[model samples]
Target: MKTRAAVMLAPGEDWKVAEIDLAPPRFGEVLVEFTHAGLCFSDEHLRHGGLGDLPAVGGHEGAGIIREIGEGVTGLAVGDHVAASFIPTCGRCDWCVSGHSNLCASAANSPGSADPDTFRFSLDGNTIPANCGLGTFARHSVVSAKTVIKVDPEIPLDVVAVVSCGVLTGWGAAVHAAEVRVGDTVVVVGAGGVGINAAQGARFAGAAHIVMVDVNPAKLEFAKRFGSTAEFDSPAKAAEYLWSVNPVAGGADVVIVCTGNTTQAVVTSAYEMLGTRGRLVLAGMSQDVFEPNVHLPGTQIVFREQTIRGTIYGSCNPRHEVPIILDLYRQGRINLDELVSATYRLDDINDGFADLRAGKNLRGVVAHG
Candidate 1:
């Protein structure tokens, strides 16, 4: 069938909304009709040659309904509501079996065609890969069952869409990876879609002080509503304030970096802002060219007992964590509505990303008709 989609034909190219063809799902795959899709920075990373893969569909975080189920698929059926996980997990893998499903073994391999020699989405016969193997940028998608999670139909799809990536990653960065505890001083860098939720997670985890760092005054102002006790326009200023408040420690208990463009300098700053045995969580996306600058000396890391950790999917299992997060939203524990700063139509994808680059929106969604 023919479907409309935002395709990144090449790196540094603007998203082009084109009519594409989708093949019927094969065994173990399900066809999804997306209701809403989130404009995540990871997709922006793809656009700017960060991932090195182009000619692909552009969105990963989305909520949709199973329009059709393929052969040999189980636990999901047509008419069921679902969310797309950027990282597909094989439940039988060692990581998944050990409750560390976030690092599924299958993730080590590329998200290739579900069936050999078959392409799901194509434009004028040229095969186009879907971003993260689950392209919610299109009106309809055929994704592997492993990457699709069942959700309650009662919840709104737009709210459910953002949780698939930013919400889960940020919230998990604090509660799961950072292990934020009662009365802890947590410093969250980058108060965008994900960083804001990191603050909320810290608050829920009982952190007494949630200091948010970002260059955007509006985003810092926005962070306060999500439990940020203080806000700063720069890392140096944030560190200064932390020292003033807790001079003895000279830093915070935990620091989470969720900026769109993470850097080694940012990591070093986060390291300097940690007390003894403090943990620094790097939860942002970055390009490969900056790989040489990601180092920290042995003395500071070993003697101080300070730990630095890199996380994907916020270290939370999607199939399990997605529902738990939705429950939080259902009970009014986390705020989803406010996270959606704006919405756009499929053709306006470029403008949506411009807003993301300009820091005008916490999250931008593409609402389909």
Candidate 2:
């Protein structure tokens, strides 16, 4: 059947909205009719060639209902609400068994390629790749069963969609990767979608002081509603205030970076804001092959016992965290509704991303009509 999709033919090109022929779900696959897709920065990274290759569908964060299930599928059925998992965990992989499905081995394949080079969509007989093998940019997709996580029907699909990426990554960065402790002072840089969730995670972990630093005053205010205790216009001010407030520690116990691009300045600033035995978490994306322009002085790091960490998907197990996160939203702990800055039709996807690039939105959801 024909499905409307946004395809990225090459780097630096606008997404082409066109009709593509979608095949039926094969073994261990499911057909999904996407209702909402989030304007995630990772998609922007794909557009900027952060992820090599092209001619692929453009979204990884989305939620939809199962239209059909292929043979041999279990634990999920048609008409079930679900969210896409960017890292498709085989469940038996070493990483998945160890509760770190984010680092699943199946990701070794190039984006959209699963089952040894088989393509699920074709445009005029030309193979089309699906982003992360679960492209949500299109109205429908035949995705690997490993990438689909069953979600409760009580929660809105649009709200569950953002949890697939930004929410899970950011929240897990603080709650899981950093292991934020009670009474800990946490500093989160870049109060966008991910950073705000990082702040929420800190709050969930019982952090006493949560300082959110961002250049945008609007975002700072928005983040405070979720969990931030204080806000700063710049990292320097945040560092100064930390020293004044917590003179004993003199800095934050954990710092997380959530900007679209992790620059040398941001890295170095995060380093400076750490207290003794503190850690800085890199939870954002940048040029895939670029050097981390800032250098950490080994002498200070060794003595202070400061640590740096790099994370993907916030070091979260998506299959597990997806359900837990949705539960949090259901219980009124995490406010998924407010995180939606705006909503747009599928055809206005480019405009949604434009708002993302301008920092005008926390998260923009595409509602397919």
User: TM-score of each candidate?
Assistant: 0.96, 0.96
Tens digits of per-residue lDDT, candidate 1, 2-63, equal 99999998878899998999999999889999999999888887787656356788788999
Name the regions of candidate 2 deviating beyond 4 angstroms.
108-116, 289-294
lDDT accuracy of residue 183 in candidate 2? 93
Candidate 1 has a TM-score of 0.96
lDDT of every predicted structure (CA atoms): 0.88, 0.87
